[model samples]
Target: MRGIYVFSDLSLHERLQKALAELNLQQPTEVQQQAIPKALDGRDLLISAETGSGKTAAYLLPSLHRFLATDAPKSGTRGLVLLPTRELARQVFKQFKQLSAFTHLQAGLITGGDDFKYQRSIFRKNPELIIATPGRMLEHIKRNSCDLSDLEVLVLDEADRMLDLGFAEDVLAIAENCRAERQTLLLSATLKTKGLMQVVDRVLRDPEELILSGARDQHGNICQQIVLADDRTHKERLLYRLLEKEQYNKVIVFTNTKAQAERLGGAIRYRRHRAGVLQGDMTQDERNKVMDWMRRGNINILVATDVAARGLDISGVDLVINFDMARSGDEHVHRVGRTGRAGESGLAVSLISASEWNLMASIERYLRLQFERRVVPGLEGKYKGPAKLKSSGKAAGIGKRTKGRGDKRRGESEAGAKKPKQRLRDQKSIGKRRKPSGNKPAGDQAGSGALGDGLAPFTKRR
Candidate 1:
């Protein structure tokens, strides 16, 4: 409770302070400290902060405060939250419920994979706060089951992810229906993408831009490492050995594809470890069951794809294993962010094969740090890879094609040598060419040149 006074100093409602106290949340996170005040002032916001930075609470508290302080009736969903995934929507809904426990504000969740009838029934009541995914929310809007005319605040959570999932049009359509003067907030891990900016221009109005520490700066508590493997088999062996050796409370192994998640989950279970699989293709119930098992310690290992695991707020994750290298640096940051949350010490290990070395290097360059390379005893990889590294620390041979001084000089020499030969051939060809005869008509000559006979130009002799 040492820093509990800091939140009160922000002029938050007493009820919210009580709720925060009950949750044992003392100090406001950096994102909360900066975002909450401006959001409370009813200003449009565009925030770029790291994952696991309490961004949910940053926007939730202010919106809840505004609702609780107002004397207006619970009209058509005063507060609306749009997320990229159902899991994230569920997570945000849970948090909203917890924070608004002492208030009269009712928050309803609208996402896919649930009973449509049940969701429609909830929408009929028109809860003051609504958390939903873009696709399902758009569907409800189209069916006339949802209303946004009275919405006072609209929050787009994980805005970049929404654009990445191709929900930009749906989100924009939903925004278009909201009150023109409604307060809009766009929160994301990165704001550099063009798609996000397009949505921002469409929705937010003169928003106050807040840029906080990014993912690279938030890796203080995570120990990152990379292990080279010869191939998939070697990677599996390495992963199996790590699971057997490392003492972790909970671990999430990330793969690039759903099939890989299933295969890895099965392999981990075969080794007698409690493991579960999560992917985008799974129904909401199935995904919830897997997440519940992991939370309750029934599953110590969860194999997941990036889409299924994004914005998931699970606690007690001590290790994150990249069973397959992430396709992008941002995805790598998000996968490893599952661990090292809430100031807990964690480990992130990447199993890199020779083919993925360049990818691993790019991730390192993106993070601006080199991961410690580890080798397991008696299981060393045969593919040592290139011994040299480029100045950027990437694998030496994988650099972009750049001409060196010698290469430039040789190219110039080759161009000069070929020019004289080309000119000589051109001159000889010019000497051998027959000139057009001035005696023939222009059209006839043109026709004779193509058809080898001037008579082909006309049907009869002219």
Candidate 2:
């Protein structure tokens, strides 16, 4: 399947083949070869493949072929692709347009930050396909602006990331609105993605489960490494050195927070590197511009957060630096997958400080891979690594985590500060302030006359 089947062998529409030729895509990837056949057969598919695999094309090609071959009227969106982020939706939309270049099938893009009226107009035109995020699509559905009754195919790309973004209910609502008779395809990077099976149970019907590549499957072409940094400043210096010394055409540095990404991007630019920042805070247009600049090689360095970079694929990104370690193995997989794409060689170096050592180790254990420890010649940190390690590669705690140890070191300790009394016993006067009724009428007892020490009757909510 790897090399035996090309796009021609899959019996795609001739025009589509022409477009593929123009894109120089002759041979089908493993995921594409396996999925295109089953998808063409109109089977519900649950595909678990590695990131940067040809999953997008695997689903898109079969869908476009079905649309192009059939002479049915385009009543509404015949195919719908639901992605986790606006970046992904844009990427898929770009690819769809490229593949359908030779045909008349139209695709609409819907996401959080676009014009609602324009999207409604897109629906009015009844395009053959719509690429959208779950949240915005649900908004359109609520407005009766989204048409799915004529939908023939449904795809959930990055299913796990959607669940992480808390789109489970929105997706279910959208699925409920779609015709159950339509074909469904769900793709995720990991099989053990939390709440992924629950979504599968409800959306897919007797689906053909395809595990072309699992999350644990290491990227053979990526050399993963770890650099110990004392702090963010240290990490920044290390990044500058990497950009100076490494042999990479393009590099991306991932941070955990949007603010960190912006700050890092600024620092990199201050070092005279053409860097760009991508995060949720930016408007869709800004983010799109940054991505455009990246693709055209106007900017070679991209500083981004995990959510913003989801499903992003750019060629020549040979180096990935985790300015901050990914919080989970699934995140780390996607972060590293940005490089070493399409069987190309890559280098992914994660900067791990003492606080992130265990998290990095946990990710290593989860992925069943070890990151090589590297050090800068003059910028090495004092905290080299752990003194003891668990069999799973996590840092072994000596005994107990000293209370306030971290806060103390960071000048945030509460030690020596007077403990403000917060217990009820510390305010016993609350009960003593009330007077006894002494068998008086209820109204009279609650009056001011019943107060002890002539205090007002605990009125005005104390």
Candidate 3:
């Protein structure tokens, strides 16, 4: 009720109230209400929710409130938030700065790209809040440039993704350095595997567990469609055709790799379309410019990798085209979720190749829904390529076709009759029945001596 603005008539901190009121944030998102209270109470939290559900504000508000509630002390690193990527750390730092504008909270950002000497100089000032990447933070700790002895709160944003990127060991090492009494908050879009739980135990106390349900479905307002692209050629053809015709004010194309993003951006630009690329390989200034162009509608088509796509708050992005399907089903959900946000109707188009059939299927399964498949009219053609799973092996009720020479044996009994009727049994017994395992002639094998070699010599002709 403290955070809920819709049903309950409750007030918040002056700054949060003013910002929420100004932004027309009429009510607390489910994640905020469920997690903020405990977070404010100084309990460790494990939260599993979807992106764009106001999860950032949920934790930020409570952390800021706790900072303000206490007496103002000399600034020191009291809170540390570890994000998976530099981009995400930057984005989260931005949000924290915006929300804490009224409060004199000094938040510093530590990531890989910036100058280390500059960062070390800022550390001398003792920032109260430090938002950083695991690798960079570890560097500071090793250099004895930063101290975690007074650190009270540790938040791991995008924990699942950090694990996916092979940062589990780094995360554990960082966790070991934090204060033993720290209130650890683990937040992720989706949580899987007990290994994640094991990490939780290593850092957190009994801690409060909050799983918000109302945030599960992000694509509710987005129209999703699957285009059947049997191969890469077909996929490209369909993508080209759609871009030529689809009416969208702004578009974001997602690719699996940085190189793919660059290539796709090049092709779109070669066609005279305003396009740009955003990936991790780009320098900070270059990435900022691309993001600015995208945000300003100066670039109508922006091709980006998943890192740039996560925690993205782009508005008016009316279309999202997945040029290269996501490697994981979870990533697929997050990719299309870029559009159709904030209750705005948008379109998501996936150019799925045969090799990606199972990836698409797994996505469908995760969303617990089926998508309508359509083919571009002029590009329909039979494609010959390597076999791909029709869907993930778990696609329900859609049986795979029998392959090799195993098809014939499926319905036949050991006797080789289509059906095991009594008449067939009597006939089989009278003449010949193939012995389960013997190389003798058919007549001798079935115990019928009259029919000499009975079709055995002819059967052996092959």
Pick the lDDT winner. 2
- Model 2, residue pairs in steric clash: none
> Distance (Å) between predicted and true CA of 308, model 3?
2.4
Candidates ranked by lDDT, best first? 2, 1, 3
Q: What is the C-alpha RMSD of each candidate to the true structure, in Å?
A: 11.6, 14.2, 13.3
Compose the digit string of candidate 1's lDDT tens values, residues 1-462.
123437778898999999988998878988898899899899999999888888999999999999888857747789999999988888898898789888878988899998888999998887898999988888988999978889999999989888878998999999998999799999998876558888898899999999886656766889999898999999999999999999999999999888988998998999999999999889989988998898898988999999755799889999999989998887888888898887778999999888898888888888888899898888998888668888776677655767697798898997776543445656664446687766766755566543456344434547
lDDT of 2 by residue, 3-35 (tens): 687789999999999999999998888899899
Question: Candidate 3: which stretches are off by over 4 Å?
Answer: 1-11, 22-24, 214-218, 383-462
Better of 1 and 2 by TM-score: 2
Q: Cα deviation of 310 in candidate 1 (Å)? A: 1.8
Query: Candidate 2: global Cα-lDDT?
Result: 0.89
Which is the better candidate, 1 or 3, if ranked by TM-score? Answer: 1
Instruction: Give candidate 2's TM-score.
Output: 0.85
User: What overall lDDT, based on C-alpha atoms, would model 1 receive against the true structure?
Assistant: 0.87
What lDDT would each prediction earn against the true structure?
A: 0.87, 0.89, 0.77
lDDT of 3 by residue, 275-343 (tens): 999987999778878878888888888889998667787778889998887776678767877787656
Strongest candidate by TM-score: 2
